[model samples]
Target: MHNYFILLISLFLLSVSCNSDYTPKPRGYFRIDLPEREYKQTPEKLPYAFEYPVYSVLVNYRQTQPELYWINLVFPKFNATLHLSYKTIDNNLEEYLNDSRNFVYKHTVKADAISETPYLNAEKKVYGILYDIKGDAASNTQFFLTDSTHNFIRGALYFEVYPNKDSLAPVLDFINKDLVHLIETFEWN
Candidate 1:
């Protein structure tokens, strides 16, 4: 009787386990504490100037073959950087525009969609295109500013970690406002 009872209990446990489905939970990222928005102007000698977040550090261009007037805004807390490059038009406005488009499109393979917003300030002679890259691309924002004559500036924001739009949405949205503010305050030196 004892042996029969043990066998019956074991069979009942196996049957119950087989009837239930096991689904794994999704992965999660650590919580981020973002700082309040504050800004400061770039140095006077730079070809162009804009207000950047006070929380970020303005670092000299450190990438390969860094050029004059190229700089990076590093967000240490977020592990991201906004790369800014300057180019003299010299009748190459079309080429610069094409390059900026190409850079934005490169992420299309991973991007769900890409949107472009034109920015024009006749008084300041600052005209540009702002790209909002969606999906899991490496960059969430890219832009190019040109006077259509002499100055052309291109910028892109990149994170150190793998692209995960869902996880980075908050940070991206926060920085987007800053980007827009920068464009609004941009001035040629």
Candidate 2:
């Protein structure tokens, strides 16, 4: 009766295994390590000067029609870049403001929400709006600063990798603090 016993045991094991529930585990991402915060001032020659993270590398933006004041602040560790474009506001402040707003809204199809945080420093004469775009939009952060008389600057933060809010939340938060610090220290030259 050895064969009979073997069959019974196999059947019992199969039934026990079938009765156990199986659940799929959620996907996971690798942990990200951020660097310590330290900043240095932008070069005095730039039309605008601000303190940026020491971890970032400042490079001139390459374009077919590159403007003198256009530059990029790149974070090599995170594969992200902050593009800064400057324009002289020759009574065209309204136009520049509209363009910045339109650029932020273009990502609404992918953004869950867009929040605007007003930044004003009367003593420094630096005023701007920081746009925090939520979700899988191309750019997670955008901002525009103006002296309201002569200078206007726009900046957008973009990552080289695909945008996944859940995966990139930690890095984004860390960089956001750096951006805020830069804004606070911004000055027109």
Against the true structure, whose TM-score is highest?
Answer: 2
TM-score of each: 0.87, 0.91
Clashes (backbone N, CA, C under 3 Å), per candidate, total 0, 0
Which residue segments of model 1 deviate by more than 4 Å? 1-18, 62-66
lDDT (10s digit) by residue, model 2, range 1-189: 999999999999998888867899998989988999999999988889999999999997656426778999999999999999999988889999999999999999999999999999999899999999999999999999999999999999999999999998999999999999999999999
Please give the lDDT score for candidate 2.
0.95
lDDT of residue 171 for candidate 1: 92
Q: CA lDDT, every prediction?
A: 0.92, 0.95
Cα TM-score of candidate 2: 0.91
- Clashing pairs for model 2 are none
User: How many Å off is the CA of 111 in candidate 2?
Assistant: 0.3
- lDDT per residue (tens digit) for residues 46-74 in model 1: 88989999999998764663578888899
